[model samples]
Target: MCEDEKSLLEKAKNGDVFAYESLIEGYQKKVFNLALRMVGNREDASELAQEVFIRVYKSLKGFKEQSQFSTWIYKITTNVCLDELRKRKNRNITSLDEEIKLEDSEIKRQIEDDKPTPEMIVEKNELKKVVSDAIKLLSDEHRTVIVMRDIQGFSYEEIARIINCPEGTVKSRLNRARLALKEILKGKAELLSYEFVK
Candidate 1:
């Protein structure tokens, strides 16, 4: 976290609403992208983003100053995403695998704003969706490890703090997560229409 964010977090922890908004404003996209990646749905990600902020609001009072604000928020977001996943697992797993259908007209609708060819834009969106789906297949521990290390770019020590695990466990899980994702991607290359660079 930056010095400005650290200062804002201090105020937010003391029940300052404006400071809380400032804190959320600083990390909103990260929290949303993390949630979106975890759940693989725009609608679900939006709902999870709102819930994540509410969780942060409620938990601010109990937060210790030991961890970075990003680490702390990530811990909360990962846990909430995992919780949502568990709840969905008991209900229906297929919800996570549902395909996104963007109409051809939707692509043409963007022609005025987008300078890139329609095919390139569609490919970009598809790749993002593939990543999201690949993430959903990981075990909770592996999933959070990848999300923090690969997606969010946290140091292993930071991930250990966020996950409340030893550094060794963080490293082991991250390695396994990478391998699993690699295998899944290998199997999914046909669907993605291009193999990811090794």
Candidate 2:
């Protein structure tokens, strides 16, 4: 943790709601982005982000200072996202890809402007479709691991804590997840496929 975050976390831990809000302001986008990508649903991600914060706020009193505050919050968010996915499975709520589209005009505008060329935009859309479809094919466990590691850039150890698994287990699951993803989206890769892992 950075010195600034350490100070902010200390204040938040002391029941300072302003400090907590400040911390949220700093990390909100990242948390939301991770949840959005993992769950592939904007509304679900937004709701889950709220739930993650509520969990953080309610559980703040019990927070031990042993780990990075970010790590703890990530663990909370991960469980929340995975829990939502599990509930979807239980309800047979698959095929909700329309829920994942950028419904917010502002975000879509940003996304569009960020794409420098029409070709890039088309490629991105195509890639997004492929990835989204492939993600839907993954079991929740493999999907979450890939989201945390590949998309969200969490360290394997951080993911281990978030998912309550051993680091070796995280690595193994990630390996299998990569293989499965490559297999599912085999023809999409330009230069390689499953061998990209090696």
Candidate 3:
């Protein structure tokens, strides 16, 4: 945390709502993205992101400053997502019938050439679905590590802190997660063939 962030934290802890909002502004997207990848839906991700902020607000007073504030928030976010996943698992609910929306910011482009044609857009959507489905198939541990390291771009040390594990464990889990995702995607080669074979 820099001096500015420290100042913001001080104000927020003293009951400045604007300061609190400002402090979290930079992390909201990352938190939501992490939740989105973990839960596999926009609606659930939105709700989970809100819940993470609420938990942050409630626990802010107890923050010891022993670690980076971002790390602490990420830890909370991961826990909330994993808990929700566990609930869904216990309920035996897996819903893939709904079409996954392709928000402009959420859609990642490969080449970034000219404006996408309709066919390109359709192919992108299909590819996104294939990847999302494969991620959803991962176990909670594998999925969490992959999201933190790969999707969220956290370093291995940072991920170890966020997930409260050894760096070696994070690396091991990430390797296994990558292999698992590859296996799942291989089974869906048809989905990627048209989109990627160019």
Candidate 4:
């Protein structure tokens, strides 16, 4: 953490609400994104992100600074989302076909091409939906690893820390997750093409 963030963390630990808000400002979007990917719903993801901050604030003093604060926050995020998923599972609520609402900005970020023909745009959107549906079909462990490493661009070390696992475990889990995702996407080979399969 940088000096400013270190100072804010200290103040937040001491019960300064503004400092806590400032400390979490940079992470809000990332937390929301992670939660969204995990839960596949915007409203639930927003609530989960709030829960993550609440947990972080309550556990602020216990944080020993052993890992990057961002990693710690992500850990909290994944835990909160997973807990919600478990609850949903127990209630027999599944959101596999629910459309994940991404804002225009997020859509642009996912597809960075500045210029594209209408056909290309339609194809990209179809591929995006197909891939997202495939990801949702993965088991929780597989989905989490896929979201963290592939979608969110977290390094293996960061993912290992976030998931509280050995680095080798993280790598193996990610490999398996990718294979599982590839298998899921295979059914939609016409839409995804060989590029995604590889």
Model 3 lDDT, residue 49, Cα: 98
Angstrom error at residue 173, model 3: 0.8
Candidate 4's residue-wise lDDT over 1-198, tens digit each?
A: 999999999999999999999999999999998998888879999999999999999999999886789999999999998999889877878633332223210111122224343355358776686677667767778789999988999999999999999999998888877876776566545435556556
Q: Which tens-of-lDDT digit does each residue in 10-116 have in candidate 2?
A: 88888888888987786798899788877887898899999999899888878887776788888898889888987886787764322222222111111112323
Best by lDDT: 4
Off by over 4 Å in 1: 1-15, 95-124, 190-198
**TM-score versus the correct structure, for each prediction:** 0.73, 0.75, 0.81, 0.82
lDDT of 1 at 119: 53
Question: What local lDDT does model 4 show for residue 178?
Answer: 81
Q: Is candidate 1 or candidate 3 better by lDDT?
A: 3
How far off is residue 88 in model 4, in Å?
0.8
Model 4 misplaced stretches (Cα beyond 4 Å) = 95-122, 193-198
Per-residue error (Å), model 4, residue 24: 0.9
Error of 3 at 194 (Å): 9.4
lDDT of 3 at 120: 50
Best by TM-score: 4
CA lDDT, every prediction?
Answer: 0.73, 0.73, 0.79, 0.80
lDDT computed for candidate 2: 0.73
